[model samples]
Target: TMDIRKNKIREAVQTFENLEHRMEPVATVRGVDFVNDSKATNVNSTWYALESMTKPTILVLGGVDKGNDYSLIKDLVEEKVKAIVCMGTDNSKIHEAFDGVVKLVDTANAQDAVQASFSLASPGDVVLLSPACASFDLFKNYEDRGKQFKDAVKSL
Candidate 1:
């Protein structure tokens, strides 16, 4: 039954525009792409997001700790991530996970995180907000988090 829908789904997807947030390209400042992937509420989802990155990335992560095992994206972070900006109330786990693997920094909110990511990025780099945890710790929901990300990018 699922397979029967494949062709139809493929056709629809081929014509579909990316929805706001969830890897949506918010803006391009200089040569950097600011992507809002605030819908990533789990490590697996973040893994996919990181895997899709073509240029060096400054990954903005953090939110409510979900007992996420960072090892799932360790190698991806190590290889593609140039720096990390933590935007949760608590970021100990984020530090522990990427301390030595990449440059890690903390931010009080999405705006701060976006600014920090921009500072860490260069031309041809990307700032990705693919938080691997829930948005409740920082915003009303994933949409709220994504909106903040977009607003910050627009400000820059």
Candidate 2:
């Protein structure tokens, strides 16, 4: 079992390494780079996005939990995050995790959330909408949530 776990971790790590190589262009873009990583849904994926940011980052994090641990991104949150936008039914976890660490706000839907995140972002800042949980609290799925985020970016 332990060997299987190690192999799984190795494979996932390799996949993410590949992802990181491909994601540099997307993550490094100047201006408000709205990253709709709504499919992240877990603490690990959120940490990856936070680690990859090349600019001041406003991370949109929240939604129905498949059980999310806010601790994984703590160091990165303190380092890279300018603000946190909670886009979910309840924002308690997000607020609790980042209360004294950074500015926090809550928005119910995609459009308002994007607008609010954009407001917090400067021209070179990155707006990362990595929910670190499920999207059923608002939109249909991660794709729906991602598309809405893109549309909102276009509107901006």
Candidate 3:
């Protein structure tokens, strides 16, 4: 039993690939990588996504805010994110929370958010969709949001 478990663990580690919607790589356009982390519906998950980023990031954030405390990611945002694209109905909270921390812009949908994030990204930078809120405002679920983000990145 111990040997079987060890073998399974080794095989899984060698073949493991993370799920499509959580920290999934969508595409590389003009040297900038696009990533979908639409499963980040909470501050802690977004923190993990932001923490794993190795390059400057243009973050696509915003959805139906579940009273999210934007302060949770404030230091990480300041350290890693170059810009932010808000893709929610009301962006006032995001603006207020991130004002002076990083550049912020409001976008209507996934496509526009991707375009805006791309424009802000330079070569070696990344565009990441790690919305830290509920997807009910703009998508059927986190999977839908991630799919839309991937489609938009592919179109670019």
Candidate 4:
């Protein structure tokens, strides 16, 4: 009985799917993958998302700054990111942090961010929405942000 239970647990773990707002693959439109990682509301979480990328990435970053230290993910961004789309009202800090590191585009909403990211991406690239700050600036919460990102991807 114990052996059977252990095997069942292992099977469940093996079959587990990614959480909704954490590295969730929203869609693959025109060979460009759109990923929503809105639960990543801090620099460290965003770093993990970037570290897992195997393809060139257009990262959608920004939100209500939570005293985030962009330096924590600077090296990973330099290595993995081809461009950054800032989806927030004020993106001066994001631009300052990534100055000369990569191309940066500022957007005010989810749809614009997705469009900008898609335009910047080529086939086989990824557009990752892993905002490294809180969502209160433009969204009610992280879940709302993730949903908006998914909706934007569906429109593409």
| Pairs in steric clash, model 3 | none
- Runs with alpha carbons beyond 4 Å of true place in candidate 4: 1-16
Model 4 agreement with the true structure over 1-156: per-residue lDDT tens digits? 999999999887756545789898889999999999999999999999999999999999999998889999999999999999999988888988999999999999999999999999999999999999999999999999999999989998
Candidate 3 — number of clashing residue pairs?
A: 0
Q: Model 3: which ten-residue window has the lowest total lDDT?
A: 13-22
Candidate 1 vs candidate 2: the TM-score winner is 1
Evaluated against the true structure, the overall lDDT of model 1 is: 0.91
TM of each candidate vs. truth: 0.91, 0.80, 0.92, 0.92
Model 2 / residue 39 / CA error / Å: 1.8
Residue 128 shift from truth in candidate 3, angstroms: 0.7
Encode model 1's per-residue lDDT on 1-156: one tens digit a residue: 888799889877765437676678888998889999998999998999999999999999999988999999999999999999999999999998888889999998988999999989999999999999999987999999999889989998
The true-versus-predicted C-alpha distance at residue 10 of model 4, in Å, is 4.0
Stretches > 4 Å off in candidate 2: 1-30
Error of 1 at 112 (Å): 0.6
How well does candidate 1 match the true structure in TM-score terms? 0.91
Candidate 4 accuracy as TM-score: 0.92
Order the candidate numbers by lDDT, best to worst: 4, 1, 3, 2
CA lDDT for candidate 4: 0.93
lDDT of 3 at 93: 89
lDDT by residue for model 3 (1-156), tens: 999999999888755446778888888999999999999998888999999999999999999998889898999999999999999888888999999889999999999999999899999999989999889988999999999999898899
- The residue-by-residue lDDT of candidate 2 on 5-53, one tens digit each, is 9999999988865542123223333366766676677888788878888
Candidate 3 accuracy as lDDT: 0.91
